[model samples]
Target: MESGKYIIVTGGAGFIGSHTVVSLLESGYSPIIIDDFRNSKKFILDRLEEITGKSIVSFDFDCSNQEKLREVFSTYEVHGIIHFAADKAVGESVLKPLKYYENNLQSLVSMLKISEEFSVTKFVFSSSCTVYGEPDQVPVDENAPIKYTASPYGYTKQVCERICADTAYASDHLRITLLRYFNPIGAHPSGLIGELPLGVPNNLVPFVTQTAIGIRQELTVFGDDYPTTDGTCIRDYIHVCDLADAHVRALESNSDEEVSIYNVGTGVGSTVLEVVNTFEEVNGVKVKHKIGPRREGDAAQVYADNKKITEALHWKAKYTLSDALKHAWNWQKNLDESR
Candidate 1:
């Protein structure tokens, strides 16, 4: 392990990034955070500091700004970088395809350029299971062929992976690992840092907890007519902390290949109704929910085949969906009490 190595976490103040920051710190890496606060907040830094017991080094700037990114590169002697700065909402990406393409691709391009310029060789990309695009097989593996993207959000991840592959192929200097994450939920378990999305929540756990807290009137099960066990979309929900730990393992991996991709998810698939019912039952709160029409572009079932990552990176999800939902509810209650 590269103990005390300086690692730059772009979007480190956001949902998954923040939890990864905690894991990085615990793993003995000095993580310098960079977030624009467009979809995140300054208050998260305080919570992060409280959890890690270290003063965070951060910059409030968009990573796509090449000039500012160059400044950050020159400012810190970075050993590696974990790029997570991208717009991730599927519905929003469908509504604003251009916005998704612009922000997501631009940031990746700038980061790649600056990483090369600064001689930062190791890169861990925050990819998504969306790249698989409603796989024909259950428990999608890393070797699964990339299908046509259902949404602009999925397209961004697909393009970014291609970009990383091409860039790595052209250069022997870069070592890239694309952690294709499934649905990541839950909090730090400290209730300090979690998914603090602005405005209306796009994810299921947040919407569920918010509705339980009375912040939202009711939860809408997006689709109930899909060809699934319960006629709703099924997803592999991995806990955020476990996902963060997987990032740590990815960074620590030693391989001869220039680029590696792993499916970061629990092997279990849970339907929307199951998630809602589990959250309510585990937290002892009834979620007011009504089944709505199936959302456009939603896959019927998509989970992970975790053999590669387990064998290669020595990482596997340790938390169950119920465990994740409990932590999510705990974080939501903390937010409610704080306000």
Candidate 2:
């Protein structure tokens, strides 16, 4: 990646995309965002500019539109493309598999076609730990077998990974980096921008925040009968800022390899109950929660063995769960203030 080159960030107005845009701008790379606003807001662009002290060029377009994507590439000389646009709700994907496939799979194909046409080789994919399904071990590594997908959304990611690998292998110029991210929580330190989940949040942090703010009556502990320390499901919750930083590193480490996949996580696991306890302790408020049956497509335990990313890109997670919770609280407060 060029030092001051422009990077195209699809879905840059979304949760992980916005935070990654901040990291890219701070690291001296200009980011041009593209989104359909189906799951994001326009105010996020303003917040990004306020944080970076630079104007951001954003396009309100869907990544699945091949013609529009080609028009974008013709208009801008982007050196790299970070594809983060996708429908990522596991439960909803089970309900709407066609929507997930149409958006996730087609958007990736459109982006790859544009990348090939524009000669932009560097591609960073926003993958998830869901690709691993129910891992056989505690801390899963990059080589962990991608078992059968639990939901259609998870299957889309697995398919996209195959698409990236095949595309890279077919061409000598394409360089791809698949950053399989774990749970990304927290907001920017400024708290000006963070995740904005539509309807009820599927993730833990947002649900906890909503309950704290009285949007929801109580949090539902998905399961407590699993075979684990606390019986609740365990996950490696990494800060969004740390996850975003890894994207910048992956973009910079462009090479002619077929495909390079890295697990972006904290190499730590926390139980669902532990997260609720932490939230209550950090926010000085009680989160009304009750243990419920395991949600379908839910994994028992999933974390990351982030040794590959640390050794390859010299990147590691810096913030802890408490720090992430604090930032998330700040972001919640900011959301309240904005409303």
Candidate 3:
């Protein structure tokens, strides 16, 4: 660990970023949160303090802004960086490819340039499994081919991974770990902070929670026509807490490789129907859902192999899918209570 031992969590007030902040603080690291509050809210920082019992160091700014990025670097002796500040909606990316490409790529490029310039040795990029682009095989391994992405959001991850690799290949001091995470669901167990999407949710768990809470009319199970166990899409839903801890593990793991890419997931595939049923079964909340047509660019089934990350970082997911749903439901309830 560097002297200051401060980690810069870009997009730190958002879903995964907020949970990661909790893990970072618990694991003996100071986190400096930088977010533009476009997809997140300022109240989340307060909730983070409630969860961790520590004042969060945050800056309200976009990571792509070179001046604000410099201010963060200069203000804090940043030893490490976890880049999670990117536009991440698949459907939105499909409709607005330019916006996805611009924000995702530019923010990452700025982070890399700053890391290289300031000699920030440890960097973790929040990549996604969408880079797989519906792999022909099940349980995608780290060596899985980087197929053409289905959306501009995914394409951004693929390109960012390459950018990190290329930058690491050229720099002797920089070490990059690209964590290709699967579907990350759930919130912090405290109910103080969790996945709170602005407006409608694009992911499954939040939508399910909202519907279960009567915030939304019903949950739409997109594309149940896929050739899966239930004719619905299959994904490995890892708890956001586990995924957050993996960031700390990645930062602390010892690796000589300049750039290491690992698939972070639960190594288990659960269909959309399975997730919905499990959520209802565990939480006793009936989610009125409908099986709709297959979404475009929707994969038949995609989960992680996860052997590489376990062996490399000595990390494995500990929470079950039901645990994620329970936490998600609790978080929704807390949000209602807070309101």
**What range of 10 consecutive residues in model 3 has the weakest lDDT sum?**
1-10
RMSD of 2: 1.7
Error of 1 at 157 (Å): 0.8
Could you list the CA RMSD of all candidates, in the order they appear? Answer: 1.9, 1.7, 1.6
TM-scores of all candidate predictions against the true structure:
0.97, 0.97, 0.97
lDDT of 2 by residue, 213-282 (tens): 8889999998899988989999999999999999999988845576999999999999999999998898
lDDT of 1 by residue, 1-339 (tens): 233588999999999999999999999899989899888988999998899899888999999888988877777788889999999988899899999999999999999999888777899999999899879899889888999988999999999999999998888689999999999999988998889978898988899999999999999998788888888889999999999999899889888689999999999999999999899889999989998887777889999999999999889788999999999999999989988
lDDT of candidate 3? 0.90
Compared to the true structure, candidate 3 yields what TM-score?
Answer: 0.97
Find the 10 residues in a row with the least total lDDT in model 2. 1-10
Q: How many residue pairs clash in each candidate?
A: 0, 0, 1
Model 2, residue 95: C-alpha shift (Å): 0.8
Residues 71-166, model 3: lDDT tens digits: 678877897999999988888898999999899999999999999888899999999999999798988998889998768888888889999999
